[model samples]
Target: MRGTIQNRDEFLSKVAGQLGQRSFTEGVERPKWKYQPQHAVLKDAGSDELLEILKMQCTKIHTDFFVSGKSGLMETLKTVVSNYGGGPILTWKDSRFDTIGLTPLFKQIWPEENVEINEWESSRGEENIELAEKANVGITISDITLAESGTAVLFSSKDRGRTVSFLPAKSVILIPKSTIVPRMTQATKIMREKVKNGEHVASCINFITGPSNSADIESRLVVGVHGPTKATYIVIEDL
Candidate 1:
């Protein structure tokens, strides 16, 4: 491993020298364009307007959208889960589930004793992927949600693996309305701010819009080809 790293560093240093620099320490500055349209879209949008934008975008992306308060969040989630077809359910081992008062459905309220209620165990490794693949519905909360693209940005970690959202037959996104941004530009800015503030930025981030769609066979579009067959986004207003 040490030798491999040394060889990789040498290769990078040689490439840097060819790029008119002694090393990568002399990095190029980010370009600042005058006609910047990225930051312009929905720049003045309020929370309500953002929600409307997200709702409209979801229509085009083929995703179900719902609005609820913290009190109704559990009922809303259960409804979507049932609508998507009940468990075996898969969810992240996030404390936020308890913080927002939705943990009971997983730990106690869910009535189907035969169905497996699995919390992601990082130690389980490949077992996590196997269970996720078998889940009827997967539930996750958005770290950041883009209104323009109807995208839920989830920062991957050991406990909240990407498979929880990727491998399931159906998926549900629970987003706090406060996290909604205008578009990808704002999402990028948020991450840049985290780095600027010396925070530990996530190495893997998944920007899921809806169920995976593809038109690979005979020009006919098919959903769930690469991911979940159905997706629902529930926005908790009071959260």
Candidate 2:
């Protein structure tokens, strides 16, 4: 284990050397752009005003509603798709759950179209690319993302894949209001503390503000270019 750590450190140092000087040091000049969450207007907002602020800023609302981490997010997703009329594509962390649990949801949501409920254990190479192109919207239950920035952090693990957040026409997130924080720097501090205590850092860390958008085409705004055009966050309060 010690030798492995040494090798990893050496590899990082070599890569840093090749990359040249790093600019992120104390008391440095500011960069050209900063990521700010589109100002939102969360309904019934309180101490954390981010949700409300985001709601005000965005043009559309898309999200997975859940009461808790164990909430039936997939079922609620079915409800949205069924009522709204979007094609249903179900992906789960558990192969068995996909086999047993998803059938009823699909039957209820997509009674007309031939539903495609696919199971994937690993998201690598071609599979990742395919999932990105095929899925119009992706749903996820997250630990905590900064409400201020309108970002959702998914612990890249076996069950919750990173691509689920990126590479979709829309990305809808489910997060309890209690987990919402005021700023990204605070969240970073918390993550660093967790890492010091041996918490598993997922392969990717994402800070999403709005839909995948670009305005370069004749200065005309367009969404869903590199990623989903819209991101909706659902906040469930304790009732």
Candidate 3:
């Protein structure tokens, strides 16, 4: 009964009478909008074009962007990790890391054996938060890549914790070229389709534009206020 309407025709009949209508009915057609400029922006751009847009937006948001093939992604990831001072790395428990062939080098990605790596595990509960807070670098796979704002959309679930992206000082995000879309318009459409098709969409969808910054303290801007101070995005071409 959670999703069921309590009243059948009684409530609708009263409302219809007030509106001077005959009867209330289900499945009313949605009205088409007259001005739809949302669809006009970046209309049907190719993935390459979208990537270029993403790169350009990254400059304003203070994020680094890189393009790499499947073979080179591992090395690219390693370079990002090294740039962040050789973690204490935290990542999601995602199988795509194995599918994209990063699993093989999981142990030896970093040349230094002293580097510690951790994965977010739902089984661990609040223990995951502590690791994320202490981690130097946190890595995550982008659920959707918004080309317009250079945003990485993260779908949080049992295996993927939200804290992994925010608690860390630095974050490295892996984005598949195939997942890139024109903007929020396309991004929301995809999520709507997922719900229409009865897909299990995660409740918490994160639209992280870049390293967190705010101009609230003064008119002057301050970076790394609430979230990551520095962020890097690795675009996997052959995902």
User: What lDDT tens digits, residue by residue, belong to model 1 across residues 145-197?
Assistant: 99999999999888998989989999998999999999999999999999999
Q: Residue 170's C-alpha lDDT in candidate 3?
A: 97
lDDT value for candidate 1? 0.90
Per model, state how many residue pairs clash.
0, 11, 0
Query: Superposing all C-alpha atoms, what RMSD in Å does each candidate have to the true structure?
Result: 2.7, 7.8, 3.4
**Candidate 3's residue-wise lDDT over 129-239, tens digit each?**
999999999999998999999999999999999999999889999999999999999899999999999998998999999999889656688899999999999999986
**At residue 164, what lDDT does model 2 achieve?**
72
- Give the per-residue lDDT of model 2 (tens digit) for 34-146: 65433233323564466554444343323333332324545665555544346435343643334334445544545555655443347454675476568766656556756
* Best first by TM-score, ranked: 1, 3, 2
Enumerate residue pairs that collide in model 1. Answer: none
How close is every model to the real structure, measured as TM-score? 0.90, 0.61, 0.88
Worst 10 residues of 2 by lDDT: 61-70
Over 4 Å off, model 3: 1-25
Candidate 1 error regions (>4 Å): 1-24, 111-115, 217-219
Cα error, residue 194 of model 1, in Å, equals 1.1
